[model samples]
Target chain A: MASRILGRLPLDEDRLAQDMARLAQAPAPQEPYEVFTIGRWVNLNLWNASGDDGDGFFNGHRQVAGRPTRLLGGVPYIGELLTTWFNTELLTMVRARNVVEWSIVPHRDFLESGPAEDFFRVLVFLEDNEHALNSDEDMVFHMRKGEVWFLDSAQIHAGVNISSRSRWSLCLDFKAGAGFSPGDVFARAGDYDPAIRPALVERAPAPADLPDRLRALSAVVSRHNIKDIAFLLGKVHFTEEVPIGASWDWLVEITRASGDPALLDLAERARRFFVHSREVYEEFSFVPA
Target chain B: MASRILGRLPLDEDRLAQDMARLAQAPAPQEPYEVFTIGRWVNLNLWNASGDDGDGFFNGHRQVAGRPTRLLGGVPYIGELLTTWFNTELLTMVRARNVVEWSIVPHRDFLESGPAEDFFRVLVFLEDNEHALNSDEDMVFHMRKGEVWFLDSAQIHAGVNISSRSRWSLCLDFKAGAGFSPGDVFARAGDYDPAIRPALVERAPAPADLPDRLRALSAVVSRHNIKDIAFLLGKVHFTEEVPIGASWDWLVEITRASGDPALLDLAERARRFFVHSREVYEEFSFVPA
Candidate 1:
């Protein structure tokens, strides 16, 4: 699994409703960052190092050097709840809102200049809207109101609001080393169920593991899983920085080792569809000058 | 313009026929560098360094350090013809053949390792067949028999042999600094015509020139040219290593400057289709771990 719901925080719906009522009366927040998101998605900074309302430093590392300042007066209780639940200092808190049928473009949060593992985030849904948070590996979760989710911010992810009304989520950023271990928190919250966890597909599997992995993949190469597997392979190649040629070689070797002719054919088709096709070139051929 | 026919070489069809006959009778050539090409494309190395028949070092730089060793006994005249036409030491020569209905996957050659400008390739069509070479910007050209083309190997390009019969081409690679200039050669060959040259889209445009370029693009943003401009914009973003957020900013500024609502709408749609869409994320998101 590329992402996990670390834990669910126990919270009162009545208190969250009060927070929402106060938030409705508060002034509208500014854009999070210049052109960082698309459509009607907007962010209201609740806490950050700089008290500037426009400072869009949502990553925990950026907030580590300065004292956390509460930017808004309406969401103090939400921040307190997150701080108590995570057992760590909350560096930044943001109320992200997506209007009807709006979406945040898929992106990794701490990618540009920060160490990804140094930051983690929690999303406390404020509205029960038809919205889904999707990871790069195609894993999606429909977060519900009063439900706290420890989101893996390191993965490429996005949010889409499909309901008629706007969707709001209180996003909290926490420094990684501040006595906040997500695994331990999940265990404590009783959400660390291995039975529900998806299979972990490595980015660059060892040559020895290729055959077994391919066999497993072959067994589940239906319409439902093929797209997910394809997305995973693409994410792996990108994250691993593997060259297309080398990646194709691995696919070929894995296909041969699978000893499933259908899988071999599927692999070839996938290479043609996802790799050799013009659409692939247009989308992925980013060779920096 | 993405591609152009540089010049036509004067050669007897009977002589080319004879060469093709001899090539057909010669021992089958080994595959070109592993996984560089796809389908039934094969290379019969006529001249290369290392004197190894399997050595697939066809790039111009690799040939500079060693003497050009003629690999086969037959078709020495073909090499002589290329030597005289290019007016430089021909480092590597290979008879590239693509079987009927075969296609080379769209790809850029010498893109990963070498400076693209350090090498230039010439393709002499040995057999007239229905074939077209496509570039990243959607430019396509068909080579005629006895015609010589100075191929721009730096850009992403591909070849498709659509004819029912095998297509043969004599490929020559020349070192860039060995008193070999493509412009000078094309001028000397009387094939340099400014009237026929297509528009030049710079890989990296200066910041000052961006506004004028965007205006020019605006003037031509018809339904027909939108896709090409979109592709060019994508190519620019990738080649310039511009972040998505920054690219969107540019698009927004350009859209406003263009003063064209249609163009602005097109830009927004392009963003959704190319950036926020799941298909784009699935194909293009290669994050180096």
Candidate 2:
């Protein structure tokens, strides 16, 4: 399995506060895909191809990781933690995502990019948010503070933070092959103990007539509320029994019933842009171009 | 007895290289005072009132120590080191100065500002520079990598880096009364060890014709070369057995011999502005206003 608990790092509240205080001085830049999130979801570059702190996007042409940016320097403990990973050469883009009262739509990453098998992903929870939840194709889970997990991003995955507090996590992208394993990444730490495994999320069964209830959104769906409706639909997958991809299907169904061709096209395009093939800079808009 | 040895920190080359690599990407900002140095003299703020990485100058009004700036976050080990201080509340502004082919002219700091006795200055040499030399009123010494010293900025002092390599040092300003002592600052470090104390800088006696040699600079010193000549004279104190303040005196004498009324006034004004009362933001320019 690509996803499993790897190891953990020592938690230091003072160090986290220092990093948080520095980040608080400036507002986080908005990510390009606005419709993918309901509330604030900021992706800050910790290590990337250009080694520039201000650069959050990946430069596909130059896919080489350089030195840590100034942002990483300010959070020295994080920088020191990165050094502990043995196969650092396999790493590429490393970023910290801080989500506050946000819900991310279900999507498969690297669908239009490099070979999914060659990419490995890791996630470390910097803080524990009780209401935060994440799900992959098969399982939903909650990552606790300092817990490091091998996140399988190639699978359809989504996240939600219903709480007002922030959920901070470091997402590490590694370009590696079948030979690379968790052992290589956690070489400095001892072999993982089975006791640290995550508990499966207990989600409620989908209510009968759920589709009819979702279809009811068609009456209220407008050009203005279309994006919010789509995000709200995505959030349903976290609490109820439904296929992760059902969120997009519901969006498409709701918009088609609206009798607005433009609304239907927007819903379809958003699904494709977020989960299927999307041009590098392709952006989905509520208004037809 | 304002300046003395404190203690040392563990030297980590990889950590140092990590910080140096990040700093190397961007040119360090020039300090406010220009005439005091010969080459690149960058004073970067690690901690200050505003907690802004870009601000290097001290704001005398708000004399409170705030959170570490983005710059300090990038150097996490340095941040950790700062926390080791027992009396961090007493600190106001802490900065790191990097000098490359630079020499600071002899002058007393805090002369026109806060009570000199209340300000406790500490210097920690970040790297070893064989050619770097610093002088207080009576003694000149070369600080090595990781060595921490209590610097007396109230007395006449100067620094020079004759080497092409960079000399980086952390300068901390603490506000306290007679109750505060080096014991409190180094409480975590235990009692001082006499074995690690610095060696005094060896110097030759001043040349018999030193006065005439400096006075003869009147022939070559002009508006274009006056600042450079002043810095060169300041550098002389690093090599010869002359009082630290002789650099300013030599400048005044050279300008008097030049018989240029404007040049004489400029020299006197430069001396006064640096070592005496200078209204905040008052800049000394070669061009007469």
Candidate 3:
């Protein structure tokens, strides 16, 4: 299942309040910070460990599977600062494995109306909302001070001023390290079917015994070995004459890896005698570039 | 509005077919090509253009976008070939000031089960599909040996091919230069609005003259000049102090820019200055990065 690790940090509310005041009025200068600021607003988002992309709303617009820049356009106290704290804290809590080394979801995706499954989302607060937590879903908790609230992202949520007074807290979203499996986060990767036309039946048949070349091909397929599958396709000889598709299938059946795209692509590319008996000049089985 | 520019090259079916073959067989070239033999083939979807943002789908997907090996996976065909063909065939043939340059439309978001305006679309290729066109959405005109057809991606559409024999053509989702407004294309840029609980009241005296600062802000706003409006906010004195939830409205009212994010963002940030009095310091405003 998709898993997430959580933790917290001691916040300096006094410093935060003072920082907020700086945004309100120009105070006497003490010294510049590591990053000079009108305030302590740091852009927090799903960036690589390298810390390349600067924070803003535009980065979060188009959320695809892996490259999800989930948050955007928010002040630091609520997001980036919290995440930075979490990352630093995570470093100390557990020394290694399945550890999330970065990012955090302070706010989530939710709209007033939509389908049940899409009604609630873990919305990244920034551009494109790059990736959205599924609606009709919830994470274990949303971060809160004193005690932590395993926020079920399923709730329609946004950052609101719970108090006229601003609150300061740490937040984090960590990518699982070596001990973690991304696909495991969801379910194990599905048993995806290849582009086999299930409706179409292969008509090729075989004798109980195998021929030498056919045997060699047979050895190639069973192991899910792509290169060997291609090798056998060019080398094997069929006892029963079969059509193009069936001939291909029979080769794969004997080798065990026949229909896999990896093998098929190789056969189509490798400079060898095509099943059609012609020495294809165009190994890719197509015309010139 | 979104924009683009598309050009044409005489079908070097022979050359393309050849190059495609080489690339397909070359152990996953990293540039623009995706797959050559697999039934489902595609091109590039470079999620890292904005850099690696793990927050959403827009980041990167080795699956759909193709992984870069020899730098050929998801790369556009950038060479004398595309350049010469584009400039000579399309751009030169037709000239215009601004065309659809780059655009993306959230097709999945706008899909409608039933045919709808500004909704999900399905491109159903009916009986004798050969009579019209073969491109997924009539991206451009499709002219085969005998017939010609115009492409239309106005709604949710999917293709159904009942032809007995296998037909050959390329199927891909790419942004090409176009004479049409990019906004009209699939996945073109669109917009969203934030919830605003605005409190607006015409003053009791029915003031004949708005203050000079307000008038100046209004002028800058009229020109859609948010930066200048921001500049004004840095130097304005309001006769009526801004009310809560109305900070954004104040900035817009005081400026000439229209009600847009750039303007609203300025107002939202200004709210961070919600102190009872401006006693501590002066000249603190939201300085955009």
User: Interface RMSD in Å per candidate, to 1 decimal?
Assistant: 26.3, 31.9, 31.8
Residue B273 of candidate 1: its Cα lDDT?
35
- Residue B115, candidate 1: C-alpha displacement in angstroms: 1.7
Worst 10 residues of 1 chain A by lDDT: A280-289
**Poorly placed runs, candidate 3 (over 4 Å):** A1-50, A54-73, A80-289, B1-149, B152-289
Off by over 4 Å in 2: A1-289, B60-62, B187-195
Question: A140-250, model 2: which lDDT tens digit per residue?
Answer: 899888888888877878887755466788888776667765666654647443358785788889878788766866654655346555666777767778888888889
Q: Is candidate 1 or candidate 2 better by TM-score?
A: 2
Candidate models: Cα lDDT each: 0.48, 0.71, 0.25
lDDT tens digits, residues A1-289, model 1? 2455454556677776787666554433433242222223446666666765555555443444333345455566675664565444444444444443333334445644356666667676777664333334345456666565667655555554433355777776666655656654322445543333432223343345433433443332332123223323332332232332333444545556647676566656545433334221122210101
lDDT tens digits by residue: candidate 3, B204-230: 231334343244333224211232233
DockQ of 2: 0.01
Which residue pairs show backbone clashes in model 1?
A238-B286, A238-B287, A239-B287, A239-B289, B1-B199
- The reply for model 1, stretches above 4 Å from the true place, is A1-289, B32-34, B59-72, B93-95, B131-133, B136-138, B178-180, B183-289
For model 3, residues A1-289, the per-residue Cα lDDT tens digits are 1212222234556654554443233211111110111112233233323232222222112221222232212234433343443333211111000001011212222121222232111111211111111111222122233222223332322121111122332222223334543222212133111222211112236444433334333322321123223322321121122221333444444433444565444444322222223221212211111
* Candidate 1 overall lDDT versus native: 0.48
Better of 2 and 3 by TM-score: 2
Please report, as a residue range, the 10-residue window in candidate 1 chain B with the lowest summed lDDT. B280-289
